[model samples]
Each structure stands twice: as structure tokens, then as C-alpha cells.
Target chain A: MKTLIKNAVCLIILLTAVIVNGSGQEYVKLERSRNLQLNNTSAGQEISINVTDEYNYLRIKVEGQFTMGSLLIELIDPSGNISRNFTIEAGGVNTSDIRADRAGAVSGQMQKAFRNPAEGYWQVRITPRKATGSLRIYSLQIYNPRTDLIELEQIEKDTDEHIG
Target chain B: MNISVRAPISKKSIAALVPFLLVSVSTSLAQHKITVDIETDTTIWAPVAYLSLIPDFNYLNTISYNHIIEQSGISKEGLYEFSTEYLPEEEHLYRVHFSKKGDPPASLILGGRDHNHFFLFAERNSNISVTVKSGNRFINDLIFQGYSPNKALQGINTMLEALDSIDQNGNIVNREYAIEAIYEDIKTYADTCSFPLPSLYALYNINYAKDYDNNPAFYRRYLHKWRSQKSLYFREFRSSIRGEIKPSWLIVIIAGSVMLSIILTMYLYSRLKKKNNKNPLSELTIQERKVFNLLKQGKSNKEIAEECSVSVSTIKSHVNSIYSKLDVRSRRDILDIEY
Candidate 1:
């Protein structure tokens, strides 16, 4: 019995070392999923993320039940310039200028690569006309080529805090 | 006499030893470690850094992480560690690159001129420490400790950075000439450096062909000096130069071909001279020569008698004398003789 326990401990330690040594590359700094009920009179929902020059890419995803031509998503840079505006169309989503849009059958994902991202807060404004459903928004700050699916500690939740 | 012989290891004993063997192997693999502490004020670098092994001493290949051996995330305390025993016993080049999110899998940003990567030298048993601080560039910010070759490489990197700053700032009037001067400095370092690996790295940065053309003797001497080194970098440097013809051997081959051609021509000329010395007519009198010329022109013995103003019997005696002097038996034999 003692020998069996010793063998199990050794096996566990070896596996743990291997796992810890290979972990961590891409970091997820911000992920927020919000379900909203919007009408023609409701105010537009705005989501903002702090993008330092170190961040190489930013991705925005929108999903859930919504009518065609009812939801509009706008990406604003640090200078308050609207870099991209996404609109929900029949069977897909269309962007104003940026071309990296992979709209799934249910959800639409928009990814943007920055050569040198401006060091300030970026905004995502979502306006809906008589829409009711849940919308998920998450941003990943890529650090290198390696990918690891590990969530970091220290998760903060707020209703609408201005970020920088 | 009674003798107790030990039996082979039983299946139970073998099974019991398996976990211990695995633990020993894992511990051995974990013996070497490279740790980096990021001290940068600005958030330019990503949280992840890659450790890549360079297959050769070619400095240009260091730009890409094609041979990534390990990838580790920086801890919350800004410490990144790569622990592995897979490294070869001999020291080799390794790059630790900190790239931003969305960066390419290989190479640095801005056509590999980005300063996010630094190099180090380590063997399988080496433990290295690095500190990255805030500076003008990544190389300027790096402080590598423990490995002597890494320190030597860092010194070369500092010089190269200084040289490049001049070009980047447009401080020199003749950019082309200034760049050539910088290459000359690197060549001088390569020639004088005591470390073979760092020396090879420095040598590969400059135009090898131009240097070899300008002074092939330097390469010959350098090759001879480092020929016996056991480092794979030295071996690679030697093989890279082998692609070109060794200048001294080329001279020997060209000179040998010219001498061989000269000797062959002289031998043929002497043979022709000996043949020329054997004149057929030198053995005959003037009357016999006239008779020989008439016989060569298809004139019979009677015709030769008319042409030479001699009797037919005298012409026949001259023909026989001509045949004997020239070593021929017939008139056709005389025609076949080469002058």
C-alpha cells in the first residue's frame, strides 16, 4: 500500500510539472457578457476597453436573437474616431470598412489587428432597434503565438465604469 | 560447497521500479532552467515569451522562432522561466522573444528589426538569469548573467547597436561608406575575438563574399585557427565557407594546369624539332637531288634522264641511292616521308 501511494505521488508530481511548464501565452484581460432589452426609445449600449500599445489585437463578438437591420455596432479608437461600424444584416453582419469579419450562423465575430495600437481607451457602441436578447463581448490581448485556455484571477464587474 | 545465486529481477520488482525511474528522468529533465524578470516601465512587451533554439550560428536566422523549444507565460510577479534538459551538451544560441498579441508566429515586427528579442548561450546543465529593463531598445534593456559566451555576444550586440544608431539618426554623410566601415569593425572583432561561437556570429553578420574577396588570407588563417574547435557553431562556420573555393587551392590548381599545358606543348615541339632535323635531301649530292625531284613529279627513269641530262642507267642508280638515303624502297615511299 505504501509503495502504491508513493508511485501515485511521483506520477502526479511529474504531470504537474509538465502542465505548469507549458502554460500561459495569450492573456484575456476583459470579458463581459450582457443581456439587454432595447426598444426604439432606449439608449445605445457602450462598452469600452483600455488598449495599450502593447496590445496587438482586439476582438468583438455579438450574438443572440435579434431582428435583421436592428443592431449596429461601432468601434471607436482612442482619438474618438469611428474605425469600424458593424450592422446586422440578413443572414450575416456587414462592416463599414474593416474586412476581418467572420460572422457565424448565430454569432458575429469581428477581429482587428493593430500595427501599433493607440495608448488609450477604445469604445464599442451597440445600438439596437426593438431588440431583446443576450449579447456577449470579450477582448483578448495577444502576447505571443502560443495559445493557452487559462483564465486569470482578479475579475471585476461593474455596470458602466469609464475605463482608460 | 553450496553457492546461492541471485535470480533475475522479478515482474513485481520491475513494476515497483517503474515510478522511481520516471521520477529520476523527470528530475533530470528539470535540471536546467532559464528565468527572466521583466522590469520594463512601458507595457510594450506581451505577457508571454518564447524560448527558441537556433540550429546554427547564422545571425540572420536568429530573427525567427522557427525552432521554438518552449513557451512560458510571465508570472504575476513578472518572472518567466523555461526549464528543460533537452538542450545539447555543447553551448548553442537561444533567443527569448517577447511579442505582443497578434504578432506573427515567427520573426519580429518591422521586418525583424524589432528589439523584443535577446539571445543567450546555454548548455543542458546551465542555469541562466536575465533582467529586461526600460531602455531605448530591447537589447539595451537586457542584462544577461551567468553565461560567459552570452556576455560576449551581448558585447557585440552593443557595438552593432551603436553602429546602427549612427545610420538611424542619419549622422554620417556617406551612408554606404559608413556601413562598410561598420562592417570592417565587425570583421575586426571576428578576427580578434577569443570565443569561437561569438566570433562566428560576428563574422556572419557582414558580407562574407566581399570580405573573402578583399582578403582571403584572413579567412584561411581564421579557418586554420578554429578548425579544431568542438563547437557546432565553428563547424557550421567552416562548412559555410567551404561553399567557396579556397583561394590558395585555386591558385595551385590554376598554376598546375598552366604548367601541364606548357610541358605538353614543349614535348610535342621537341618531337617536331627532332623530325625536322632529319632532312632526306641532306644525305644526297646535288645531281641526286635533281633526280629525286624529277622522280617525285611522276617522271619515270627515262624522263628523269632527260630532265637531269643523265643517262637512263644513271637515273636508275640515283633513284636507288635516293631510296636508300631516305629509308624507302619505292617512289611512293619517298612521297610518304614527312619533312
Candidate 2:
């Protein structure tokens, strides 16, 4: 009986260990534009972050000051697939309840499922709405949870912005 | 004591029922019609203009329809088009667009002048003129026609300015009164006129003045009176405005959450199952892994075979399996894999 319990505990621990390593996350910083005041015109800013690790699940979030849905974010994965996209809309967060003051909390997650991601260039493109306002701390963040034992948190990448 | 009742059928009884049904159907079909005079100086600008009568009263993201002057433009996703040709005269019949009889009201915009640039309430038998002055008037109101836009664009502009307008001491004024006043103004038009555009003018006002958004009494009692006024021009927008307002959002949120939960549960379960069943690392055997490590380190097949005390052919076979697991081709491709 003691041996049976011991074997069960060992099996549980092994399963837990594999599960812990199976779900690993990496954060990628895409763009950083601080304290910007935009007018009655639109501007687009883009950046590329190299995700050296392969992942199955991908999520995107924005930390910004141009209101909830004023900024449009489009993410292109390394394999040239548009992973996540959101734009200025009429009702769902875009054309209403925008403050021109301090920055707010991180946006809700915009998630996607990848068949199998490549380890190459992942692009984040942003299109601020054609509005006149003041803003602070506009940036994009990516959280990728992988299924492999690869250590994504260890790989560090920084890149320049691409404007359109 | 209660009495049970049954009536026998007759031609007279059936004939009486016919008038009642006909009255119901005719009342439903007797929709409001408005003649519009849109005088565009075609000599001033290009003959092309875009027109859209999008439904604002919809909670679900229903695709709306529009038309182009030249009819040569391509349709984009979510926005569709109807075949159109300019009547050559500025005076045209601005079709009255409404939902089914006893349905939610819809708004209309006209511009021989410009594509959906002016807000003209699609009222029953409303006669109005919208003549754009010198420059382009990209607004949806009668302000540019005969008077200055200040007072004419009241429903559209007043609500916008009221939202963020500050007081003398630099404080944001409570916009309740401002919003209430606009509704009161729209109510004046809604009461005096039986047209669809007037109701839509009031409807569009509620978009900016959100406090008055969901009123079942108003939709059921007032909008239900004008169902027969639906036109093909605004057919898509007409069908999309459905059900009670807040419940629509609740249903959408619940449905969305349930779908996401299912997807996430499946995704995570698949990942766990793949890890257990595949044992991904075991795809390459002990010998193949050693060969893989050597190949990653830039070693030739001959050198790897010599180091492993095996023939070159054996090393080649191991290398092929390793390459297959890693989804790569050739020795150069497998060199320096960071993942």
C-alpha cells in the first residue's frame, strides 16, 4: 500500500513538471511613443520583434493614452499571417468614452491560436484614429505561451519603429 | 356560473373578418413618402459621390448598404452597393426608409450634393431642399441648405459639444440638461410630424446622448406605427435592428464568452495531449539526437559517423530522421537552431 501511494505521488509530480514547462510565456515590446498630441489626421506606426521561440497560443494587448478604441493594432506573425487586429469602430470602444488625460490600464487581451509559429520577424502595426487629442504612453505588448520546453523568457529582443 | 361559447362560420362572418385583416394590412403598407430636391452643381465637382444610409439603431454589427453616383466603384467588405444612375436633375425623390410596420425606426442622408453628407430625416411625406453652398458640406443635416449650419446641425453638433463642453471656471458641465434639451427638441419634431426622417433625426441624437438610449415604450409604441415605410435602399439596415436593447448586448457577451471558453479549453487540452502522446523529443532516437547536436555544431556527416563509431550511411539515416522532426532540409538549414 505504501509503495502504491509513493508511485502515485511520483507520477503526479512528473505530470506537474511537464505541465509547468509546457506552458511558458514570453513578453515582446513592440513600440513606445510617449506623450503624443495628435490632431485631425491619421498616422501609422509599426515595429518588428523577432520571436526566437516557437509557440502555439498568442495574445496581444495595448497600453496607451489615445482612448480605448482609438488606436488600431494589426499584428503579422513571422509566417506572414495576421494574428490579431482591432480598429476604431462606431460602438465597441472606438467612437465613445475617450479621455484626453493620463494613460489607462492595459487593454483586454486580443488573442489568437497559431497552428505552429515560426521563429522569425513578427510585426505590430498601429493606426491612431483621425482625431484631435493629447495622449501619454502608447505601446504594444505580446504574450506568447508555448507548448515546448524552449525558454522564451531568456531571449531578449529590441527593435526600431516603422512609420507609415 | 360561466357560459361556454362557440360560433358557427358563415360567408357574412368571413366577409366581416376580411375588412379587419385588410385594414391591418393596408395600415401596415401605408408608409410615409417624401419627395427630396437635391440640387447639385455638377459643374463644381466630379460627378462621383458616395451615399450611405447606415443603420445606427442596430446593436449587432449588421452589414449596411450604399450607392455610388457613377456605379463604377467596387464594394468593400461589410459595405454593399445598389445600382445607381444620376437623374440629371437636382430634384429627386428621397425614398423614405423604415423598418417593418411596428419595427424600430431608421435614419436617412442625401446629397446629390455629396455621399451621405447631410442628415435628412426619412419622414413620411417630408419635402425639403439641401443645396450645398461654396465648399463641400460633409455633415448630415439641413444646415447648409438655406441657413447657417450653427442652428441647423443642432442634433449632431449640440450633443458632441455638450459631451466635452466646460464651464466658465474650467470645469466639465454635467451634460444631462444639454442632452435632455436636444431630446426635447427632437420630441417637438417627432410629435408634430409623422415622417420617418424626423424620428431618425431623434434616433441619431440618442447616439450622442446615450442617457436616453433604450426606451422600449418609445420603440414599441412609436416606431411600430411606421413599419410599412421600408424601402429596398435601406433593406439591410432595416432588418438588422432587432429585439430589446440591453438584452441584445447581454446575449452577445454571453455567446462570445462561451465560444472563447470552448476554444481555450480545446487548445489547452490539445497541447497537453500532444505533450503526453508524442513525447516530441523521442521522435529522434539517442543516436539521431547525438547526430543532430553534432550537425547543429557544424560537424560534417563523415566526422559525426567517425565520432560515433558508425558508418557514414548509418549517420545519414539518423540525420534524415532528425531533419524530419525539426521540419528542416539539408545540413546548412539545421545549423544553429535557437529553439
Candidate 3:
């Protein structure tokens, strides 16, 4: 019985060590959305959005003068691939949601996500229609369904511990 | 009849006597004397007229006129109509005057006398037309000669003085011509006078050194004495100018400093890296430490083998195991590790 308890204590210590090391690996937080202003007068103004280690869902919102031109958003990955294409026409100053995984395989598409590609480097391209006007984007949100479930479970556990 | 004849004869005789007496009385004559007186007048000759020659400047003197007489010669009154053939072929100035007293000391007047064949000498050429007249009559052509060098120099000096006066009064219309004349005078003086080259060089150097900064080589070549003591002269020249630095020396100093800094930085970096790589975890094991300590204190591997009572291969195996456990790849790695 003593040997069993000792073995159990050792196993617990090893598991604790493994857990501590595993959790020690850093986790990064990304802002849910960002606003970008693209005035058509200037060219090569790059807007980079990071989508690594997060759920693939993306939502873009735009508000500006709309004409016959189109707004183009390209999803890029680690291998320099255009994994998805999102197009919105004039008067389409609204939110558009997409899942990057379901997008078809194409040349120059990002294959797998990266942990840290580079600081401020883009995994996506957001290009507005070239016209004589200013474009104001209100928000871009990357939503993960798994993050909601995890937050819900945490809240439940905290409530149970508090009641007990 | 006889008586009548006697009376007639007597009467005839008486009548004849009367006729004879009348013939004798008829021979009478008359004589008268005639006398005549005559008067005459003579003209006295006057002196010949002459024109006096005057020099432009004092360096020249007037000379006598050698007049050539024509076929008529000079008139008794010394006044005659001059013919073209009586004019002198060569031109000159003559101090000619009229003289009725036959020669030199007679009273002189401005009357021009021309000869047909004599040459006259004068100081300068005449520009005015000389029409010799006693009252309103014209004379022959007059000739004039030019001044000699001495006289020319005097004339030129007077002209220069006049030019100077004009310049002071601000009346120089053609300044370039005046400058050219001045330069020609300087060149003439320089060519005629013997001046030392060194002195001339120094004078010009002082005059132009400030504005001659662009062509140092030209000055240097012409003024070789200045370059004879090159170092001293260069030092003086450098001090005269502002902020003169030798580019070659600056380049050497900068390159040397940069190379030295790079080498020193690399040396320090390599030393720190060597110190960091010498950890016991990377170079030593526990068994290796024990064996090394025993070997350091003079224990043989065979004695170790005998004490452990193992074969030599087993001892070798233990040694190999010690080497592997020490995490050392070479003996040098072990030796290089600090205690």
C-alpha cells in the first residue's frame, strides 16, 4: 500500500512537471478587429492581418464611397498561397464572413499556418477598389467557435467552485 | 639922122648901167641857231619775302633755305612769279625771308620762296596749305620733313601728358586704345631696359598672388626660386590659406582606426564565446571526473581493473562509458573544460 502511494506521488509530480512545462509555452493574444483607411491617392499601403494559431473564420467590415469598382480581400498562408478570395461590389459597404479552410486549393496559396511568421508580416491582403475616394474599414474579426466553448466551460467551473 | 642915133645909144648905156647896179645889190642872206632839253626816271629794287620755320617741340631747330633759281633768276626787286619748275622736288622747312640788301642780315618777312631743284629739311610734315602772298597773290607748293627720334620722343611725351590731362578730366572716349598705348610703352621700356628676371618675378608675384590662386603651377614654374625650398614654402603657403589638410594622411589615419576597432571587437567577442562553451555539463561526466582524479593521483587503469576485479575490456568499457556519459566528443574537449 505504501509503495502504491509513493508511485502515485511520483507519477503526480512528473505529471505536474509536464503540465508546467507544457503550459509555460507562451500563448499570444490577437486583437479581434482593426480599422484601416485606404485613400485611393496612395499606392502600396499594405494592411497585414495575422490568422495563425486561431480559428479560420474572418469577418471584414467596410464603409466608404462605393461605385462600380470592387473591393478584394485575399487570404494568404505560410507557403505564400492565395488560399481564398473575397470580393464585394460597390454599395456593398457591409460585413462579409468567410472560413479559410473550405476555400479551394490554388497556386500561390498559403498551405499551413505558422506560429510566428514574422513581426507585422501579413498572412492576408486587403485591397480596396482603385478609385478617386477614401475607404474607411470599421473592423475585421477572427471568430473561433472553440474559444466560446472554452470560455463557457471556464465560467461553469468557476460557478461550481464558488457554490461548493 | 646922125644926131638921133647918138642920143639913143647914150640912153641905152645909161639903162644898162642901171641894170648892172641892181644885180650887184640883189646878192644879200639871213642865219638862226636851235637848242633841245630831255628828262628820265629809275626804279629801286625791294627785298625778297621769306617764311620762317618753327619746330613743334624744342628738340628741333630751323635751318637755312637752299633756293634754286630758274632761268630768269631772282628779280632785282626779289619778287617774281614762281614757276612750277622753280619749286624744290624734296620737301623741307626753311627760315626764308626777304632781303634787298643782297644777303643774310636783311629784314625777314613771311614770304615763301621756292627753288626748282633743292631739297629742304624740316622737323615735321606740314598739314596746312602754305600760299605765300605779298598781299593777295598765291605762291608755289611747299614741302616739309619729319622729326628725328629725339624730337619724336619729346613729342610723344607731350602727347602722353595731354592724354593724362584728358583722363583726369574724364574725357577718355576709347579707353582700350589708351590702354594699348600704355602697354606698348611698357613693352618698349622692358625690351630696351635690362632688368633682372628674379626682380620682375617678385614684383609680378606680389601684384597678382591674391587673384592668381587658380594657377599655382604656372606661377611656380615661372618663379622657380620660390619652389627651391619647397617644404618651407609650402608650410608658409598653407599657413597663409585656411584649413589646408593633406588628404593622404587623413585617409591613412581613418582606415587604420577603423581596422583596429574591428579587430579588437572581434577578439573580445570570440573570447566571451569560448568562455560560454566550456560548461561541465557539455564537457565532463561523473565517472570521467572520478577516473581523472585517480589518474591525476597516480592510480593506473590496470590497478583500477584489478581492484574492481574486472577484465581489461570491461575497464575499457567503463572508460568508454565514462567518456559517453561526460558528453565530450574528444579528449581535447575534456582538457579544454575548466574545473
Candidate 4:
């Protein structure tokens, strides 16, 4: 009876671990969504999102109901190099980041040459300014959506959670 | 004429010297006299005026003006005509002062060396007028009333500058293109500038910078219209516009065009990307995308319900909503999506 009980306990723990990891992994498959809370934010605050190798394209979208705040997001590759960036501002300024805008997209798929990408760890850094609203990350993985040919769904989250 | 040589030499030597002297005298005859008639337009003053020439216009010598100090006495004596022996040079810059004793000081008289062949006719108009060629009398009495022969001096100065651009640099820097550019500027100014001085300046520019080897009278038409306008605003506006645009304008246009192109490209690219990422499933709430992702992964309605910390019926309702948006009938259709 004790051996049977031990086996059952082990199965439960294993299953729990699998569920958490699976939740994270499956979320990255396509149009992955994640929520990050911003509260009483002050200066010198930063958040980094590391995109691992396995996804073919890289695009990031930021959506949230912000009453007052600004955020600057930058992409860093595995080589520890910054690749792309974007800005969200209610009232703020843009930094003097890399000015190579010919390949301007900081949060889109691989540029001009298709099927070829900077295959490695791509990191995302977010710097917030007077931010007090939740920022929704609509994509958590290298995304290749099938039916998103003509539209992007505005995220319908609880308005109370996003509005500052 | 009787020739009597003092008796210091022989008759043959005198005869030889006489012919040589006679030939030299005839060859070196003094030039024809310059006859300038100065009379006020409002009241033809006793045709008395004195004319003088200065080698350089800006280097005016106050002491030399209004005096009887000319090689050929050119003084107005109770008459409008003043005569001085013609200068050896074909063209000269002259200043006119009334010969009347109580007349206004010569300093009060303004002068300009602008007379080109145009001055021949200008010798006929009202402002200060002059002529290098003959026909000063036929000079339109209308032109002589007030003319400044000094306009040519300014043109000559600019012409020298254009030449110097080539000479001072020892021809190491080519200025033909720049001179041609200035020619175009002058032509445009001549075409539109409403101010008298600027139009005059434009005539000067064209006269100085143009390659007369191609067209000498290119600026001739502009000279006739160089009348001072009554409206200072229009005059100043027209004069101010010429130098405002240069290659810098072209640079601004190109830079602006490039900046616009870059902005447009970025905008379109973002829109295309947004379109490509469009999915009806994206409209789902964060909770719904979570459930939808699980559903897309071939999870059964029960598995999604079990994993989500929600009841099975709630999960079923979410699935049905997802199916409605995906335009599919069931979970099988969601799995069949070509993601």
C-alpha cells in the first residue's frame, strides 16, 4: 500500500511540473499572449524578454489601456547585440537608438531575405517611464500564424486590469 | 602755313626733320572733344555744367570735383552744352556738376556708370543719363534729365570679380559653371524682380557673368524696365527672393524627399506585418487565447478545462466562442488550421 501511495504522489508532482512548463511552452507556439503588471514604476526600470532559437520569425506587439506612461522596447540578439526597437508614449521622447531604419522593423519578421534570419537568442528589453498600466505582450514566441492574413485581433482583456 | 626753322642747321636736315615731324603730328592728333549738356528737367538751367572723370568711381577726390581742372575744359557757361576733349579710352566714368556758381554742391549730384550701349538711348530718358558714343543731343531729352553713368562701374566691378574667380585661382578652380549659374540667376531676377536697383543689379549680373560668346544682349531687355516702382514692399520682396534659393534649396528638397520616403516605407511595412499577423483568434481575451492555444495543440475540451483552473462548462463555452471567431464548427476545424 505504501509503494502504491508513493507512486501516486510521484505521478502528481510530475504532472504538476509538466503542466507549468507546458503552459509556458505552448503559449509560445503562435500568437502567444502574456501579461506583465506595471505598478508605481519609477525610473531605471527595465524588463528583458529573451527569444530563443526555434521560432522562425520574430515579431512583438504591445497592447494595453494606458492612462499615463511611456515605454521604450529594444531587441537584443544572442550575440548580446541590440537588433530592433519601438516606443510607446503618452507623452515622452525617443532615444538615440540605432538609426538603421532601412531595416527599420524592430518587432517584425526577418527582413527582406525570407527564410533567413539571425538565428539565435533574441532578447527584448523594455524601459518604462512613469508607467502605471499593465502591458500585454501579444506574442511570446517566434510566430507563424496561419489565418492572420488580413487582421489582428485587439486583445479583449479585463478593462479594469489594463486601465491605469 | 610757312615753315621757318631757326638757322642752326642745314636746309636738307631741316627738310628731312620737317616731313618726319609733320607725319608724327598728324598721326598723334588729339581726340574729338566730349560735349555733355547738363540741364535740369524741371527748369533748363543756363546750359552750364562741368563734367569730370575719375579713374575709379569709389575713389572720389573731393578736391578735384567742380573745378576748372580738366585736360580739355568741359565747363557749362550759361548754356546746357559742356565740351571737353575726348578721352583716349573708348569708355569713361563721368560726374556732372552745374556750372552755375550758386548751384548745388557736386556732392549732391549722384552718379552711376551703368551706361552700356543702353545708355545711348538712356541719353534720351529722365534720370541721370550718359553716352559713350555720339548723339548726346539726340539723347532723348527725356533721358538726360537725370542719368547716372555710374551703373557700368558696378557691372564692371562684378565682371572683374567673375574674371578674378578664374584668374585669382590661377584657373585651378573652374568657374565657368558658377558663372553660368549666376547668369541664370540674373535672367530669373531680370524676369521677375520688381525693384529697380535689383533689376539693375540683375542687368549687371547678366552683363557681367554671361558668356557673351553665346549671347551678348541677353540682359538688354531687362534694362528698359528698370524703373523704380512706387511700392517699396513689392520692390523689397522681389529683390530679396533671388539669393534665397541656391543649391541649398535642392538639398532641402532631396533631404525632405528622402525623409518622406523612409517614413512612408516604415508605415507600409508595419501595416503589412500587422495584416500578416491578423487572426480572428487574436480577438480572443487573454484567457481565451490561453485556452485557444491549448485547444490548437490538439488538447481535448476536457484537458483544456482541467488545465485552466476553470470549470469544464466554462472551458466549453470558451471553445465554442473560439470556434465562432475562427469560422469553424468544432475543435477538429481548429486543429486543421495551417498554423
Best by lDDT: 1
Worst 10 residues of 3 chain A by lDDT: A103-112
Model 2 lDDT per residue over B102-166, tens place: 11111111111122233333222222333333353433333322222223344444453333221
lDDT of 4 by residue, A91-161 (tens): 22222321222111111111111111344544456676676556565443333332131111111122212
Q: Chain A TM-score, candidate 3?
A: 0.36
lDDT of 1 by residue, A39-124 (tens): 44666878887876454334433333332334566668776865545443222322321123322112233333332345588788
Q: Candidate 4 chain A — worst ten consecutive residues by lDDT sum?
A: A105-114
Question: Can you tell me the DockQ of model 3?
Answer: 0.00
| lDDT per residue (tens digit) for residues B41-77 in model 1 | 3465556777878787544432322355677776877
Better of 1 and 3 by TM-score: 1
Q: How does residue B46 of candidate 4 score in lDDT? A: 27
- Computed on C-alphas against the true complex, the DockQ of each candidate is 0.01, 0.01, 0.00, 0.00
For candidate 4 chain B, the 10 contiguous residues with the lowest summed lDDT are: B108-117
Chain A TM-score from candidate 2: 0.41
Residue-by-residue lDDT tens digits, candidate 4, B69-116: 232233434233333333322333344444222232121211111111
Better candidate by lDDT, 1 or 2: 1
lDDT of 1 at B165: 47
Task: Put down candidate 2 lDDT per residue, A1-164, tens digits, no spaces.
Answer: 99999999999999998876655333333444444555557587766655444333232333232323355556676656454453333113111122212222112113222222345777776666553444333233334444222332132112212321
Best by TM-score: 1
